[model samples]
Target: MRQHQNRSLKERLSNSAFCHFEQRGELPCIVVQHPGFTASLLPQGAQLLSFCPSGDTSWIWLSPTAEYQQGTSLRGGIPVCWPWFGNADKNSPEVQAAMAEGQPLPAHGFARTNRWTLTRLYEAADRVEIDMSLPQSHHIQSVWQGDAELTARWILTPTSMEMQLITTNTGQSTLAFSQALHTYLPTTDINATRIGGLSGHPYIDTMTGWQRKQQQGDVVFQGETDRIYLQQASPLRLVTPQRTLLIHSRGSRSTVVWNPWITKAQRLSQFEDNAWQTMLCIETANAADDWVNLAAGANHCLSLRLTVE
Candidate 1:
């Protein structure tokens, strides 16, 4: 029996607002709608496709250029990058390592490109809960050679959304990996928006020769901005003309902020180059120097929440 079997479906969906499976575009999806919030999930990659709160625009950004084809990573929304985060662009990146030894790597790992099983969904008066998992299997073990299982859970309320990723080592050997909830957030104008609560924190500017610098104030964008801010747990605020977004998290040691700006934006599928001003990415992560090492039979959980004010 699977370890997740211990939790029955009835108990899991007892408080769910409403859960159903339906076709979304070209893919089959699980859709959840409650009083003030609505969300959709694709079992492929267990990807979160959309999230919206009543009276507010969609906070999660799904690229118009994103491909829905199976086994491909969508350019937007929250692509759960596991066993690694981002591309192995740098020499000796953490995603290419395991148990102190180098291992094969795929950009953002294989989690987001594979299918996930829906384990449970719950409907409640005020919130909806969802659970999806990818268990250890021959194909999964073949890719990373780690006997592990991954589970993703989400709780959505009228005004907020939360997601958690739990990984357990089911093999006899210890396993190590880095990960992120690469959340693509929407905005009215990327250039005019400012991110507060990270002033004075240090970050690595990935595009500027990977230079390390301390923030002067709330982060603002003028051009291409791709940075990894280390060890900042304070809530993040996105100030835009139309609305304000509050992003909070637990079990996160790093926050990555990115916007392809003009140059890189044109290279993405399903994304219009000029549309760069419409979205920004503030990811929750344990990447680079902060990878996790799990002992056999052990588990770790990473979580995040989003609210609008």
Candidate 2:
């Protein structure tokens, strides 16, 4: 919201060949049009709305019916879930303690709804670098009293894209929180999709009463599926008929895989009733037993990388 910052952003973007700022639908977004790929970024939530390598369908699936209104998160791309994940009651006691008693907590925290300031932008022959941060304000403190700063960095290349969410505890107290890079990936067919590298891991089946279970083999879609894999660090492969996407992560122990097949898809916002057929969410996370705790002046980062072949 700083006038000088906006001026700098406009000036730099105006001088770029591959990147520019444009109004998409109802929101202003940054657009990248490199010879190798094209991507769109929204300042709200610091979200990547779309990314497509040259000659390929978009790897990031955005709902056709999605609205671009403010304060509402779009149905796809990488939604940054922070401070706490899922429900307020489901967070760790320390994280839950930060919230006011008897107040309703929004799912996935408030970071995604608040606008972030673009702090850095750089473009090169082979890649583009972008950095943004959430400015601290009374609106943030009213929900979670802890003082924390969040920054998002994006690195884009011809063949791949990487995102990093950095959290710094700027205040003088210990803080606890959970977060995720909720990436919605596109698939030619959801039923034909299989996720590898989680065969032997333990998971919490949120769809089945949060039951603890072990994965039998590759994960495949049937009905609605929602599972939280615990302590996961290995790379995962999302295989479909047309192509395969390799997903890598760092600074995260938990991973979440979700798909709303039929029943729930109709009830979601910014989503078509049948939109679940083409998207799957495989999130890199610090969640549940793997929640993060940062001492004063400490910082933590959660990153995700995606490559398609």
Worst 10 residues of 1 by lDDT: 1-10
Best TM-score goes to which candidate?
A: 2
TM-score of each: 0.88, 0.96
Lowest summed lDDT window (length 10), candidate 2: 1-10
lDDT of 1 by residue, 1-309 (tens): 322432343344445547655655555567776667788877777789888887766778887767777678777878898877777545234345442245555777789887777787667788888889986655565666666789999988888889999998888976778889999888888878999988888888888888988998899999988999987665889898778888888777889999999988888778897889988899988875667878899999988888876
Model 1 misplacement above 4 A: 1-17, 89-95, 99-104
Go through the candidates in order and give each one's C-alpha lDDT: 0.78, 0.88
- Considering every candidate listed, which one attains the maximal lDDT? 2
Give lDDT tens digits, candidate 2, residues 1-309.
545554666776898879897866656788999988899988888899888888988888888887887788888989899888989889889888777665677999988887788888888889988999998877777788778889999999989999999999998989899999999988888989999999989999998899999999999999999999997956899998889889999999899999999999989988888888889999999988999989999999999999864
